[model samples]
Target: MTTDPPPEPTGAPAPTSTARGARLAFRRWRRTRPFWAALWTGTGGFVIFFLPMAPLGQILQVGVGGIAGMSGGVVLMAMALLILLLPGQRHTAGVIAVIAGVASFPLSNLGGLFVGMALSVLGGSMAFAWLPEKPARRRGGRGLLRRTRSAAETPVPPVSVGSGSP
Candidate 1:
């Protein structure tokens, strides 16, 4: 007698709405965070340098602007680098950085421009050093490793028996 055929399996379950929402959130974060951060950092750096320089004639101390400006510069640069590194938002960052730098000039009597520029460089450099680079990953070497290990662990197939050999 002949046997009956097996039944077909049904399709996979659809992804839940929560998963969909999470995915959407992730996309937005990836797309928007970088630009916003870059802008914020640059603007903050500008303010750090510009705001303190008002009242155009007072004896502006070296320590006053230097420390703050330098620090601000580092922050701004980091933000810029982050925008680039983050892979989503440099356009916003670039625009904000330049605009803020320009704005700082008038706001802080041209001192902010210098300070912001300095900070941007310093921060960007530091971020560059910290960010991971290419040329550090494995390509197809896993296949070789797997073959060697399998040979060691598994036994060779048995030889034919009809020849009467031991």
Candidate 2:
């Protein structure tokens, strides 16, 4: 026997169960802000931060390196959060992240073995390059190449004839 689906309440909208719905929602959320930049920067920061804790021989014992790495990583991570929280300040965050990533190299286990440095730099670049969406100017589904009637309706003034030799 086939089981019947449960009935929904009269006024409530049915919940979406499909993964596609989730994906669409995520896409919409991503388009509105610098989501990828934040993710990459944060990941890089975490890598940099965790490397000091990892038991790599002689890696963490270097004088001041461990502290430097942790500090740089924390800065990068904070920049990522700032980018996500205040998109208008993304440029500032991006610049700070890049500087921190570069500084981490000599300070933090070679910038978490170079992985964290690369990721943070890349994320910062992406954030700096990101642009906000512009509102569409066209109405009535007009194509960019299509000319408006107003332009075509305007009459070109006839060229006036003048004596060549005065």
Candidate 3:
């Protein structure tokens, strides 16, 4: 024989407001990080770009590529900055760094090899560091994450037969 499920009561107050507030707060925090990262990266990149393409380029044979190269540097800076600032999955900071580092070589002078590498590493490091880490367990693996599965994947348990009467 089949058993009927208990009726879910309606007209109850929802606790969704707290969840909404938490979501909003997380979103704001998420947005703020990359904002700062982008700003710093862009500023540092432009400084590197201008130093070579405008002034130092005249003296150093390394900076001879002109606007295209400088533009490339800007692009690299933007990418690197984004990688660091954003919260999502981006293991590509290394790739972005490679491009920026290589391109920065001619623009910043051969001496720039050192500087460019440093900047590239800095960009990657900043992104890695900027990402939020989950707090450690207060009671040794007793956190919510330990007991829960994603809603989509959770299995529903089966019910048994009658309990009291034979």
Candidate 4:
């Protein structure tokens, strides 16, 4: 005996919210090398600019003013923005960020200098190391949907009546 197929679902699938979609997209983007580099470089630069550090005179025994100690951080932040905005130019931006980070050593006090330099260098390296991933090619000629056999193409076995004789 044949049985009927299960009934189809009564309602439509749940709709995804725009906010959730946006969040998912953002999460995916954050996983990329460029995003991490931009984040680290930007955060490092901001820290250097905001955090208090030893006075220039105390660190280098020079008469330079406090503003001079924050210039490297500013450069780092600018380069990070460039990398984020124009990923195609990441190599150039990364190189500039590295140079600016190194230069920050002499310009800034010890506190911001080491941390800022380390973060900026790491970010720059990440940017430089980024390589575009290639898309995978689909295999086989089959479409996404599965093909079902037509009723005519399916063969049915012979159904016999109760016959006791061999």
Tens-digit per-residue lDDT, 120-159, candidate 1: 4443333333322344567569867776785568778998
Cand. 3 TM to true fold: 0.44
Off by over 4 Å in 3: 1-44, 55-64, 111-113, 125-131, 136-166
- Better-scoring candidate (TM-score), 2 or 4: 2
Q: List per-prediction Cα lDDT, in the order shown.
A: 0.53, 0.87, 0.57, 0.73
* Best candidate according to lDDT: 2
Span of ten consecutive residues with least summed lDDT in model 3? 108-117
For model 3, what is the error of residue 164's alpha carbon versus the real structure, in angstroms, after optimal superposition? 50
- Estimate the Cα RMSD of every predicted model relative to the unseen true structure: 17.7, 5.9, 19.5, 19.5
Estimate candidate 1's alpha-carbon lDDT, on a 0 to 1 scale.
Answer: 0.53
lDDT of 4 by residue, 1-166 (tens): 9999999786755456667888899877665448888877887777666554565566465445346657767878998998887888899989988777666666666536588778888888788787766667776456432346577766889978787767
Query: Mind sharing the TM-score for model 4?
Result: 0.62
Candidate ranking under TM-score, highest first, comes to 2, 4, 3, 1
TM-score of each: 0.31, 0.71, 0.44, 0.62
- lDDT tens readout by residue for model 2, 25-87: 988878878899999999999999998874656555665778778889999999999988898
List of clashing residue pairs for candidate 4 = none
Give the Cα RMSD of candidate 4.
19.5
